[model samples]
Target: MRKIIHVDMDAFFAQVEMRDNPHLQGKAIVVGGNPEERGVVATCSYEARKYGIHSAMPCRTAKQLCPYVQFVRPRFEVYKSVSTQIGEIFKRYTDKVEFLSLDEAFLDVTENKKNMASATYIAREIKSAIWNELYLTGSAGVSYNKFLAKVASDYEKPNGLTVITPDKTQALLDHLPIGKFFLVGKVTAEELKKIGVHYGRDLRNLELSYLVSVFKKRGYLLYDFARGIDEREVECSRVRKSIGAETTFNEDLPLNSEAARQVLKALAEEVSMRVKGRGVWGKNLTLKVKFSDFSQITRSMMTSYPIVEAKDILIYVEQLLNKVDNLDEKVRLLGITLSHLLTDEERLQENISLFEYMESLR
Candidate 1:
């Protein structure tokens, strides 16, 4: 059995805001995009949870739920620092750490220093360390596989711990709601209910072949999950396939030769740090320009080999800039993308996408 532990930070972004500005603690606070416009809530505090406000909900509706709620913009810098701190804590446990996002990650401590044997202990220690180092609590779920480990984490909220032992799998899964299982996302859960499979027991009793007939390819996956039999490894998912960052200014930027270069340089540096930070290399560089009127155009190029180094990416970005017409006018935003990719010609020649030839990573 693989020793997998899923660590999820509790209300990560909201918690950070609360920590930095203690005045927000114990109040209904939300950190995300604008509410009056087409904005949505990224995260909310426990206090906001009282009003049924959750992440990704339209900010307008969230305001309807709690008019007094405090809304704050996202602080990526602060969150990144906290994420790094949390990652350091995971490294203390094991090197086989797979970060799912800023808030969640998986750690395989099968050959831990202490040979702790129990994944539960590893989860507890990790959660404790997060609180100690970052002044925040994290929920942990430990199990023999990634499926159960992730499910265990969501069983509780805000500083909770749960374990799924091999022997206890059957009984534990029996009563668990189908909605709570991994891969059975919101849409799938509703679909399952329509099919009369509301719990693990219902799905487990389902014939694999019959499921295959109804859900087709996904049926095979449902069958495996029903029995708590997951073969998926704690994949050290790539830092990010491609890194691109964009910003919308409060005002439009002029389209002078110097202004364009200045904007392009800034965007290039920002995107460079994103992709280069992960040590990812790509052959294709794409530039996106959003005009003040919201008209967008993208220019792309394919290099002979991948450009992992930041300077190479920036140079390619500078070259691609020549493709855009300067007389167009002031721009609202500029964006850059470094693709872990190959040219279309290369793909046709190889008869497959770069991913397939690279490995079965996809």
Candidate 2:
């Protein structure tokens, strides 16, 4: 059996803020942009969570939830520096580290450098090292596969470590809430609940054929997950699938209005900058718009040649915006994404000039 360990820092961005400013400890703090500007919460401290605040919640809503909650602008550079420190600790025992984000990673130690027999012991040592070296606490989960390891890590919060041995996997999963399953989001959980599938056991009881018929490809994953099966490897070098940027407006903008067009232009520029920084290009441009009622829609355009410039992206953005069926609705958020990415090397091989590509499209 493969030995995988998943480590996730506790309320990472918030914790970093609290750690740097000792006076902020034990206080309700949120790390994000200005509430007055309709910014969203990146993360909040445990003290703030009591007021039903959560990540991605609008800062305005968070303020209403906790009137006295402190807000701190995020310091991403410092967090990335700290994340690098944590990564060094992981390298001591295993080189098979797969970082999911700045605050969480998966380590495959089936054959570790330490030659340690117990993955549990390695997990403990790594967690201890993080606390000792960086003054940060992380929760770790150890299991035979990535899915269970990730679930076990999240079973407890803050400073926690949980292990899911092969023998204990079944009992724990059978009682696990369907909402807690890895890939089951709020919508999927609600849909499953409507069918009386509230827990893993309920999901396991459903026939595979029935699940596939209803949930399609996702059904296959659900069926396997309910039985504690995840065959995915801990990929050490994860590829960037897309580059995107988005903004939520303080006040809703009329759909397809000049104001909305300006926002799309800004988002396209941001996406373009990021794509160029990463030295990559893409052929697929997607425009995402969220309405005032929280209804969302996305329109995409695929081109024969790669897109790299903001002007090029804006052309498709306007076209996609025009394609929206709900032009009468007001938009609360606007986002632009470029996918079907190709690296600098790959783009060179394509041998297509941006000018020629634009001409072809016209």
Best by TM-score: 2
lDDT winner among the candidates? Answer: 2
Task: Write candidate 2's Cα lDDT for 1-362 as tens digits.
Answer: 99999999999888999989999999999887577855567789999999999976768889999999999987766876798898999999989998876788999999999899999999999999999888889999999999999999998887999999989999999999999998798879999999999999999999999999999998899999999999999898765788888888999999868878766766665676456544568889998989999989899989667888778998888788789888878989988999988865678777656657768999
Q: What's the CA error at residue 17 for candidate 1, in Å? A: 0.7
lDDT of each: 0.77, 0.86
User: Mind sharing the TM-score for model 2?
Assistant: 0.78
Clashes of 2: 0
Screening candidate 2 with a backbone cut-off below 3 angstroms (N, C-alpha, C), the clashing residue pairs are none
Work out the TM-score per prediction.
Answer: 0.68, 0.78
Pairs with steric clashes in candidate 1: none
Off by over 4 Å in 2: 240-285, 289-297, 301-326, 329-362
